[model samples]
Target: MRGRFSQAWSDVLRGSAFPHEGQAFLEQVFSADVFRPRPDHGGREERFALTYERLRHINDRVREAGSTVPLVQDRERLFPLLAWSAVADPALFYAMFLHHCMTTGAVLEFGAGREDLADVLEELAATERVGALLMTELGHGNSNASVRTVAEYDADREEFVLRTPEPAAVKFPPAVAAEGVPRLAVVLAQLVVDGAECGEFCFLVPLRDADGPLPGVGVRPLQPSPWLPLDGAVVSFDGVRIPYRFWLRDNAVLTADGGFTDPFGSPAIRARRTLSLIRFAWEAAVVGLAATAGASAAVAVRHAHRRRTGGRFAAGRPVIRYRNQQRALFGALSGAYVARLVAAATAGPEAPALTPRSVRTTFLMKVVTDRIAERVSARARTASGALGFLAANRFLDYQGFAHSLNAAAADNQMLLLDGAQALLAGTAYTPPADEAPAAGDRDLLDPATWETLAAVRERILHQELADGLRKATGSGLAPFDAWNGLYDLAERLAETHAARLVLGTVREAVREVAGSDPVTGPEAAGILRDLLALHALEELAGHDGWYLAEGLLDADEVRGIPALLDRLCERLEPYAEELAEALGVPYPLVGAPIAGEDYVGGLAGTAPSSGTA
Candidate 1:
């Protein structure tokens, strides 16, 4: 049984040397003492306290291993833990990412050569102080280039005075002081020297200590975020002085004569390099969202398998016997697998340099995964009925994460539009190779056929968008006006491109898994093939109209998708339990009573301890 799915899936999901170690760490720290199910009802402060404790407990255990953070030092191990964390709690996941990936990652990457920064990193690693990265401001949310917060060089004092020039300049959503833990942030502010703007740069600044907010720093709590709760707040600075040594520079120096010398020729490039740590944040979001999506589907499937109901045709039959339940639950499960596969390939340990192309790739991968998570979680929640609505069931946790990730790094829609504009303007985009119309003649169940159709659609859409823009611009329409004329198609093109990219990633993984594991190789290969087929069909089903319009498919083919989906769902029903258990979400983390053998008995807190099967 273990060889069937859990072991095979675990081998594929973890791309690092720390698979067993990661699982051990989760089991050790997530014992009853450190980990607890979220309360059915709790106040904001109460919930915030739980999130804080969760962060501290995990960091404490990691410190016990070594002085330097292992995962941060070698991020190959980060995604596995992030996925597990997301299955547990979205808020906990948020805090963990900010501390380990955002704050600690930035320091490790750029805070070299500074003894003060080293001390701060040590404290952060030891969980003595919390960490955050503040780049977005209330005034210019998501527009980092136009941040109004300024750090003016005080040459006489050999320091920088960091100040939020106005109310709008206040940093929003840092969760800085409410935890009552010592906190530090890597802040992005415009550098000003002698009344001249010197591009955006990062600085290490202390935001709070055990006592309270640091002097010259003001913190105000914002309303708790819906579904996903954290101690988020808006922070302002009043002449907060930062020592010259605190500046995070990448071989950039301040000359004694008050001149700045940077090896990177341009400030824009320097700024991009400064915020490159954001890639880790994106990776974290992908892994976490993938895990949550999978876990949600798992719980929903388990419930559907056990849940019995009466209908006009049958009495006391398992809900999984019904067509509606199978479609909702199995489809979600298939999507979950697709999401996990995509994350495994895209969010690898190796970090790519930040560029327009890489940024777009990361953004679109995140967007695609985010959409999958949202859809899977919503279907899971609905499939479970009233039981799913209960906080103790854990479906809501995935729902919250899915919704939050859509806007977490930046709003997905805005990013999609921005990415579309870049692609339209030829920002290093490589469209999928155009395929011949005959490519569509292959069986719909063939992954190759899905890949071909998706690629052809993307290529056609890109060409149409480019030609439309050119024709409109040549007709004397403003660039924005011309682009606006095809806004719907532009967005569709972006989505199709993202879907193709994810499909390409899934295909690669399937090929690798087919040849890699000898023990359960055939079984694993069979499972992946089925999942890949279902995922591909799901992606193409939505654009059936477009596919028919473009002659990629005939009316009969398009009309057959519904029945095809139902058949796929029925085929996957037997393996649903194995798939859910193989996701590696600990039973305790799910905390769903209905998922247990005896739902009624388990409701009294008699569920088995949290651990993998």
Candidate 2:
């Protein structure tokens, strides 16, 4: 048992290498997690109390590392943990970050605020800590060029006095302080260059000295976030004096004399690097949520397989006897597997090219991950029966993660539109869309992006990002079937090209790394070949409607996809455990909710610990 747990820990860490275990572990530890059925006949209320207590303990740990003091003092440890947690609960991601900055005595200039910052995080990180930055007003999220927060140079006092003119100019949804005390605030007020607004730059302003609130910084927290615990707030400035040197450089370089130097290309590019940091977080969060859902399904299946009921073959056999249960379990498991692969592969980052295809792929992958997680979790919860809804069962935990992931970010949709735009631009992409389209009519090849994907793909989106976002706005299609729809023929072509890019690189890398290995070895090179074959077969399969209209595929090759997937699943079956191991998820033994082959009795969390199965 100890060995298994250790191995499980190793597997998880191998995937993330972060300080914390994924949230899925949070649900199953000591088997006292949420979603657990009452064991030893304990009262449901008692069990729930236990679960909440467990969660609170974890939350306590989160506050400890995520607080401002921890962030400032132990930044190295804190950043990795924050990145990892983003993989788990992205909603908690930014909130915790803001909390850390406020509690740790750091200043925000463009994104977060300063008023009451110290108080809020002090409760979490300890007292007498605060920071501030009120840059993003209610008027915009990324339109920095249109910013209204003004900071004019007061040459006499040698300070920049900041002010907010209109209500929209007030930075609502900005990071703020609690208890009205702040130490340092780098406000992102528009720098009045030669009597004109010269873009935006952060200015270091002392909001509160050891005595009290500085001079002109004011704030208000958003009443509540839509889903997650987003402690959003509004902020404004009135003649706030700040000594410079607070601007996070790499974009709009500001000289001490108030002159600007933005030599690294456009301001948009530089600004995007900052957004990339958040994007990294979203990516990590989406992946983490998917993994959590996978664990939830695994647990639910363990319970379902053990809980007995009437069956066709046996007299009230295990619930796993039901086809409905298997369909739910296995289908979700497959999705979890696919999602896990995608997340692990894409979790790092992509390039900063604002190209539509790249944006489309990124957005599609996010939506795909989000949808799979939400759907699988909802199904898994139902599979757990009444126990799933109970706080003790841990289903609600997964639901919390899923709903939160679904409730953030509008950029995902924009990415999809960008993908459509990429498709329109004639970017060729083709890999396997189906196996043997037309039963070995190898002539169905489409253009592939072999060159670009082969070279540099950037370090995690060309810089920083913690990962995951929920909210879906715009066409609502992103939340609906946008991810599900088959893209245009051009899109399929792009997919084919993209798949080749990935597979080709993998094929080459495997040659160097797995020269003597099996499956990946020469003996099993067929698997890789078949995988690529399968990819190509499927890539063009989706554009059948358009393909048929455009004569991309003849009538003979259209009917082979089902067989292809069927064959692929069968071929991939023998290597499933090996592949799962390589990917770093724990094996089935550790995934059991309790302990039983049938997943019932004492193991299902319903019965007492009278005997082991």
Candidate 3:
């Protein structure tokens, strides 16, 4: 029964989230011998070389199979492919992500409908020239709008002089320079025409060739992070000349008179559009994170079921039988499923363009999903005991990957604050309808009740922020003061909004499952619904103090959350191995010793103890 339901649940998840191309890549390329994890033999350069080798191997396999790396424009195909890579290897995933999503995506997106960029696009598609994106400066942090890199147009030469003026202007932490590969980056810089700043634009700047870093370009690799080793570097440009054709102009015109004209009259709007490619990066990231979360949970649960502990009273019981252990493992398993559902909703060919609405949603999605991945990975690592710390088990690697994302793409907290500020500025955010009578009106077990509670919290917080903002400003506080005074509320509102969205996505999956496979499907659906309740209860418990103070959840109700959570964990306990299997992570990809049938036998120089040993 467990096996049947596990297979059914796996079908429901992978069938909904991964596209055919993505599924095929995972089965064929990712499962192949070339993509397996190998021991690191040397130092930084050698590790980076191995990453590139894996990347080249995958690229070759994909090409040989008559498909190229899917760009952000084809994110439905792109995301799942990246997700599988992330499951296989973090370093390989990071390199592939940058190459396909950041670099190739920038060229294809920013240079869309332009004839001049066709050749370069082909080179990127063919993996001839590696791609990278340079946007965030060392000093500017998340403030891409304030970057000091300048591209001054020299009319006489018809070339743009790209320069990082001061120490602060150097682009930080992109793996732009590899030893033998030619690399190009879509660099964001303030464009100047005859000393007049004409907003920021992306320019295709060459960073390196076979010889070394290109003349007038500087690349200094940063200190290696042992957990996630990449060829990350700080790059600076000293008057590197960019040709006229390399400008990634979208409906912008430059004539012989040294004047620039754009459809967007507002400099702010243009700047937003210039940084729009980051949206795709966010989308790609969550998908990879979803996969990592799932893979991590799968590894932990598999290990839990096989390993035995508690010899004081019971001679040897499965570690998974403990309530505390069950919580750690199943909580992660549930979070992984929720994360995947959220990722599935966010990515696809039908994903909206860079509109105001899409921007806010995607930003929130990235921030929330980053936190989910972080929490899920941490729990998975803890559940596996000492084995989780080993690199070969992949739990530490998964945790490192998740931690890196919290800062990469964009800092998660900063993204939330920015998103909250936008929401506070009259951006359209419809609170979930007032359906459930405030708090005590519905059954706790109903998914509808959880959804309503989450929505209500978000709505109340949003309203409170708005009312406080008006009151503060009316009392003669400056605009900045008004915002800073209520900063915490705004941040909470953003987080609640994201949690609400995640809750809704998980519930949607439950309903879909409930509607399918009348026989075995109902069992899988019940398991998923329990997961949804678990996720909702977890979020609600986090804000229980707030909920109690707000008079939404009484003290008694709040106290009962732990017991309810335990019950959910207990009910789901029998299916722990099934849930892990349902995540659809390949067996080779898990590759943890304790997860195997014979844990002691799998360990090096270890044998099963005989009774008389």
Choose 1 or 2, whichever is better by TM-score. 1
lDDT of 1 by residue, 1-613 (tens): 2446556665665555335666777677777454666545377777777788888887777667664544665565567667777887888889889988888887777766666676777778777878887888888767666788999988888899999999889898787746577888889998888888777888889999888899998989888877888788899899999988888865877876678777887778777777667777777888889888888888888778777897878988989989888888888888888888878777766776667888888878888889999999899999998888877787777888888777777778876787778877788987777664573466887667777788898889888998998899999999779988888888888888788777777776667677777776767767767766777887788788888888888888878988988887777777778877777667777667777766755666566523223
Q: What does each candidate score in C-alpha RMSD?
A: 2.4, 10.3, 3.0
Model 2 lDDT per residue over 1-56, tens place: 22212333223223432334433443343233332333232543343234334324
Instruction: Report the lDDT tens digits of candidate 3 across residue range 107-197.
Output: 7777776778888877776778778878899998867879789999998889999998999999987886458878878899998889988
Local distance difference test, per candidate? 0.78, 0.46, 0.79
Task: Summing lDDT over every window of 10 consecutive residues in candidate 3, give the lowest-scoring window.
Answer: 604-613
Q: Which candidate model has the greater TM-score, 2 or 3?
A: 3
Sorted on TM-score, best first, the list reads 3, 1, 2
Model number with the top lDDT = 3
Q: What local lDDT does model 3 show for residue 28?
A: 77
Candidate 3 at 379: error in angstroms? Answer: 1.0
Clashes of 1: 0
Better of 2 and 3 by lDDT: 3
Alpha carbon lDDT at 593, candidate 1 = 76
